[model samples]
Target chain A: MLPAHLRMLARLGNGEVTMQVDGPVTQRSILDALEAQYPMLRGTIRDHVTKQRRPFVRFFACEEDLSHEPPDAPLPEAVLSGTEPFMIVGAMAGG
Target chain B: MPGVRVLVGTRKGAFVLTSDSGRKQWEVSGPHFAGWEIYHMKGSPVAPNRLYVSQSSGWFGQLIQRSDDGGATWEPVGNAFVYDGVPGTHQWYDGTQHPWEFKRVWHIEPSLTDPDVVYAGAEDAALFRSDDGGLTWQELSGLRRHTTGPSWQPGAGGMCLHTIKLDASDPNRIFVAISAAGAFRTEDGGETWRPINRGLRSQGIPDEDAEVGHCVHSIAMHPARPDVLFMQKHWDVMRSDNAGELWHEVSGNLPSDFGFPIAVHAHEPNTVYVVPIKSDSEHFPPEGKLRVYRSRTGGDEWEALTTGLPQQDCYVNVLRDAMAVDSLDSCGIYFVTTGGQVYASPDGGDTWSAIVRDLPAVLSVEVQTLP
Candidate 1:
């Protein structure tokens, strides 16, 4: 049987985009894949050494707020099952 | 049809002006919220009766006032609206545990779709959100958690939430620009946020760390094309066709590249407006020229529109929220200056005329047309 694909929803300032990934993904793996695919997005999603989510960027999986969650934490089971979606949101405002 | 009403927020207070049919005669109102330094005043899009003003008093601290009777009477959102310092956290610059205690509210923007949802930016580099109509607010942890180290310093005025742009199509989608922290966006309300500062530039930073948290003063987005956006940085006017994924300099033709405000036409996505000021040294209109420039093709080309503006020495700096474009099909472009003058261009900035002058130092400007 083919592994489930997680639907990842990413929202930037101007618009929103969605992508799909096969397998139960951790935050680190997902970010790695994203950085590998879009080199311009490498330093954007997470910090280089700490691998922590950037200040203006937040992560959400299965409706749970994962902004402060550790990067290595396993995503929710619903996301693993491909029934739930993971979301990455951008911070709004300049102060 | 009733002409557009322009709300001018000034250092002393707030004022209102209504234009005549010919877009000539001006009826000006009081210095409402007088004696208080008005940082920003926004006329609610959902309810015309609601006008929100953010004020800062040196001895009293930051306050958000609401005027239901159209700037006639005002009341604070309650004592809960006050901005006290965070518990035990000290700011790096001044080493003050709570710099917000002495700070001012720079901008107050209420969500157009949800009038009850409001956001305020302060001088201490903090962003606060209120769901219950400004009665209370919670600090967005996402910004507080951002660690830029000691070198990620704020600009002259300090890190602040100067502007907040909500996706008209999706209320949950919001964009915010910070002075030294750069720009950020959130699509799922405030639960999570991402830095959309790609293609943006910092003064002397290398290519690697340039996009993360560069200073951004103002941002303008096309109503129809969410993917297209424009921003006024410290040194350049930039546009991103891919929603800030990458940005390119669009102020090539402008007289000056340094500016605080940028506005887009209500109906035309390709048409935009910005008031250019000289760079850090001069920080005034280019060669003392009081004119507003229009970009008809997304900043590809710009044309100076100065029909009635002063041709002589006119040193003025338009604040980030001082310039506005009306929602009418044949939009009316308006802007106020720090020199206490308001200029209006009825035919989409093709020509210009001064509506009011010598009132007070204008801080922010908002325009609304009553039915």
Candidate 2:
């Protein structure tokens, strides 16, 4: 699942994007695969140079906030096995 | 009918307003890239149909959009704006040395002779140029590495290189202005630059007549005489006769001179336009009135053009890049207010009418007179 703005920007239909992760699906691996699949989403989700997640963007899966997790940490088993969709969210913050 | 296309960048999205030569009966299109901040949209001087847009967001970062068929459709171009080399530090808001960081693009200036070449002015005050249309960009780097780079600080707004003027008579010469950093001129294309701020004065700075740190709001020049320039500083209206070598106060008879966005007439190089707000702190017209002041003799003397503008109980600001003029025989002047009003003067500021009301707080406006 993705934000409405990011969905429109990536031209994805009204559904979750499923990609084939080559190896163990960590946060870094999933993000690297997603960015490789959709090049335009590179800087939108993370900084171009520092590669840090943008301040107002969050990641969630299995009904838990995984935004603060280390990039090398393994995602929830449900997210890795495709039982639960990884969610990219725009934080409920400023206007 | 010779028509005009008015490209407007607003707080929420971008809008394109089209009209026939009469400048009446406009057709407005978009909220293109809806729910995004469109900072600026500009067309190529050689190929008017080729357009470039700066689409950015706090959460999603910066993206460049390009249009080939006059903004009917757009494609995302390059978004990477990596600073050159070490990306050194400049003065931060707290008067401490902070490393330069890329935030967003404030302006996009396409080359005069090529549709494939373009320039972008970015926040944190840097310049980038793209040669292969908009596919990639490289920083000029010399401007940021100037000797006075450490002393530059942000104005009320973030430190942004918001103005880029390419001299038509000499392709190698280009001029750019930054908030609180004053103006700079490059003689050998983008290789070498020097601060050209001799005669400008600002009260708040340590030295009133320092080389940099004047906080230039906007700058304008007529293509016919690129040597002469008009500037709307943070408080005063200024003019330079020798290609920005020395500036002099031209605030003369205006009720107030603290405003953004100054423009020159399309055909008459001697005529100029400025919207004077009350003061630096209060960014609105004086006496609760909205007026567009015109000077037929270039600078000192000015006349308030409020025939169709509101003369009472109006408090809205015209931002630094919101005013633009079209090159029609009759000469059309257009500007957008923070109140979401886009006003047009079809006959050279003699009278005015709102082209459209209730937009998303326009950030910039540019006009293209189409054949």
Candidate 3:
């Protein structure tokens, strides 16, 4: 299952988990595909102009926090092979 | 007219409160686009069903919501607001140069006769026009490119184009006011502009009657008399009879002239409305009494209308865009306060009732008198 931040796309998508990897399967490609389909989530995950990950949003997969990793970098074999779903998380702070 | 629909924009979301011609029994349907800052929502004067809503968030930026069938259902429109050409800088809070940024829309003025043509006023103080409905927008940069753009600064609120007044008689004439930057008029459509603040005296600025640095809170132009404009400045209510060419202070009998939101009656050209807050520092009704002052002969004489409002222990501030007037036969008045209250007066301003209570802080209120 994905984290709570990526789950907001379920309200607009066709109810599928969108686990299919078409080409290269990079983090940027997946988010671009998701934001391409659901325009409402455009700026929530990343800066609309800077294209940087939002300060509060993070990327996680295969028991590793990939938030600071490069967007075009490849993922672990578990995530690449669909054994684990890419997770978009809202980081906790200030509490 | 069949009924009235109040398109209310709040800090969280948008709301639609409808009532029959009586303006008594209302059915509230909202918070549409929940968990977003709805700065403004308005219906087209030509097509009442064509509604436009401005929704934004710090995370998601700005989005325009349009509903062809009134406020029943909505679809998201374009959110991108790109400044035209060289996108220069304005005076920042520290008296430094700050690049213009696209922020939430402050006002939406749809065309008088076209549902597809609408205008949006945005923060960073610029005007935008959408010709193909709201699906796309282009900046009318002449106003921002006026010679005095460098001297313009933001009010306590960001530098925002908060008011847009289009002349019904002359389609070419357009008037827009920005906080801390005074008022401007465009005679040849949107191609050229000039400051029309000749007699405004803002003590906060170095030159009290400077040409371009007055914080105009709100400006209202009666539809019948488009040339006559009424303004609620940072401290006083002013009037300009010759289409903003020259101005005079008409705040003779107001309790306190420091407040936001100035509205005009639907039928009475000489009748106007303003809620008198205590002072600039204290942004609430005087003596804890929420009174709406009405001037029958424009601005000198004032009478407080306080039959159905809170008398004491109430402190709700009214924002500049939170008041509106309907054009029914008897005329209807509506306003929402920062304390989460929406007050309505069906008989003009005689009596008031809280049609809505305990919502998020209201940002703007606009009414559509339907046939």
Best by the TM-score measure:
2
Report how far off residue B181 is in candidate 2 (Å): 0.3
Please write out the lDDT profile of model 1 over residues A1-95, one tens digit for every residue: 10011111111333333345555477777777665554434334554444656565667777678878766778888866667766766545232
lDDT of 2 by residue, A1-95 (tens): 88988898889998479988988898889889988988888899889888889999999999999999998898999998899999999998767
Show how many residue pairs clash in every candidate, following the order shown: 25, 1, 0
Candidate 1 CA-lDDT value? 0.72
- Residue-level lDDT of model 1, residues B137-235, one tens digit each, is 776656545543223456777767797887888877878887776887777876667778887777856664564557787999877887788999988
* Residue-wise C-alpha lDDT for candidate 2, range B248-335, written one tens digit per residue: 9999999998999999999999899999898757888999999999999989999999989999999999999999999999999999
lDDT, residue B58, candidate 2: 85
Sliding window of 10 residues with minimal summed lDDT for model 2 chain B? B200-209
Top of the candidates by DockQ: 2
**Model 2 spans with C-alpha error above 4 angstroms:** none
Give the Cα-based TM-score of candidate 1 against the true structure. Answer: 0.75
Question: What range of 10 consecutive residues in model 1 chain A has the weakest lDDT sum?
Answer: A1-10
TM-scores vs. true structure, each candidate: 0.75, 0.99, 0.93
Candidate 1 RMSD to the correct structure: 18.5
Most lDDT-accurate candidate:
2
